[model samples]
Target: MTNSHEKLRMMMIIALFAALIGIFSQLIIPLPLVPITGQTLAIGLAATILGARYGTYSVILYLFIGATGVPVYAQMTGGLGKLFGPTGGFLFSFVISAFIIGFILEKTRFNISMAFVANIVGMIINLTIGTIWLKLFASLTWEAAFLGGFAPFIIGGIIKAFLAAWIGILIRSRLESAKMLPKKATIS
Candidate 1:
């Protein structure tokens, strides 16, 4: 493909992933400090497939939509309030985590184990930032923040990470076989 065609394809994929993130955000299991949502899973999938730059762009696009009062966040909430709210840090972490996950996948040979590890690291980053934000925003003690934000979501996070890795690798393998993945691009 020409440069323009490749750029267009990447942009389209980014938009698709951003839309998927918005849709996934609605699948929420409300909790005390934070909600369990499919957003992370979508982030992982997008990152693993789109690579670092495009993956981060996808997250940015999603955030932009949410910030514009699109009702794209959990519980159908959106706007600047949601972006600056208690769960905002976790939401923001998606950008970093997706970039990290995509970077790792692009640098390393694609495998379930590598993807699992990358996802775990990404989850840890998200949880750490989210816990700190919860404490600050809610004015809770560290223990309280851990309990409310990190503790409750540990099991679910692990499950989601594994699922993300497994599914992402599977899809990536298929795409590779079909020669749909760009060889010169960062995607792996």
Candidate 2:
């Protein structure tokens, strides 16, 4: 395929995945501090599968839409204001988390379990930035921040992390079977 065609196709795929992330970013079920949604799965899975370049771009596109007041954020609301809202830190953290996942995956030869662990690591990155920002922005104590952000979602995050990693492995295996990746991609 030509470079132009590849570029267009890549753009379409990125847009499609970003839109999916945006759409799924809704369905907010309240936890302790922040709302939980399916968006992180999309982010982590996309990062693990697409590599850092496309994954980072895909998340950046998602954030751009949200910042423009497109209601692509969790709870179906958006605007630059959301970036500074109670849960804003996590939103900003998404960029780095995506890049981290993609970068680590590319650098390390992780098995499927490892890829999921990588996804969890990415989520931890998000939480780290988010909780700190939350504590600072809200002037809350560590306990308060934990209540609002991290503690409430530990179980859920664990589940999501495991699922994302498992799914990543499944997808990687399928791609390998289809001859889209090398046989050694599994690293099993």
Candidate 3:
């Protein structure tokens, strides 16, 4: 493909993953303070496949869409109000988590093992930021944040991490073989 074609393809893929994140965001398990959602899993997959720059772009696109009242967030809610709401930290953290996950894979190797580690780290980032945001935004105690935001998601986070690693590696390898993705990641 020409340089322009490659850039267009990458942009299309980024938009697709942004849409994927929105679709996954609807997969919610409701809770009191915050809900468990598949947004993180999709974020992990995007990072593992797209690398740092493109993956982060996808996340930013997702957030921007949701912030614009697209109903792309968890529970099919959107607008800046939701983006800055108590649960908004998780949404905001997706950008950082996606970048870090992709950066880790780009720095190391794009294997399942590395992906798992990256996903785990990403999960922790989400939990930490989301918990702090929940506490501050909701005016809750630290213990309440730990209980509502951090504790409830631990087991689910582990499971999602493992799944993202396994599934992401498989999809990435397949895409590389099909020439949908380059053999190695790139910044541009």
Candidate 4:
């Protein structure tokens, strides 16, 4: 069983990851449809490195921060209004993505290849949900959603996934070395 100290540390790490991602999200990465935010990258890394419980919390915290009037969301928008806006789906999808990524990583062994697959799969799931949610809000057809939102971001998504997975794997390795991460807890 994990000790209280370890659990506390886990919570701290989850909060830290959320904050880190929030900070990165504030820094705009130019894109056609929606300017890039570090949410995806951070979510991927958080999910992979921190495990599912903390990973999901990190994403939930991010949404909570945005909903609570923090101007850390994409386009510097915030509050409950943002959650109802067109981008709301994407924001909500982040939580799902984080959960899936963490679950996949926890279930499998942590290897660069497996991490890569998990990141890609998890991101795709989030993207699908976000795009579909946007469609419902805007009355967009699937073709339109795919073309308008998903298509434009494919390449960028791949790049972000690569970086997130790479960084996560590296961080996981370091944590394991320091005995902060369990050796046998992770398979492969």
Better of 2 and 4 by lDDT: 4
Off by over 4 Å in 3: none
> What's every prediction's RMSD, in angstroms?
1.5, 3.5, 1.2, 2.6
Best by lDDT: 3
TM-score of each: 0.95, 0.88, 0.97, 0.89
Clashes of 1: 0
Per-model C-alpha lDDT, please? Answer: 0.87, 0.79, 0.92, 0.79
Who is ahead in TM-score, 1 or 3? Answer: 3
Per TM-score, the best of the predicted structures is 3
Candidate 3 colliding pairs: none
Return the clash pairs for model 1, or none.
none
Worst 10 residues of 4 by lDDT: 179-188
**Residues 71-136, model 2: lDDT tens digits:** 999888999999988788898888888888877777885467767778888889888889998999
lDDT of 4 by residue, 1-188 (tens): 47776777667777798888788787676755556677788889988887776788888988898899988787677899889876678888888888888778888867778788888988788778878887888788888877766777778788888888888989988987887754344333
lDDT of 2 at 73: 90
Could you tell me which residue pairs clash in candidate 4? 109-187
lDDT of 1 by residue, 41-155 (tens): 9998888777787889999999999999999988898999998888888999999999999888879867888888889989999999998998999898999999988888888
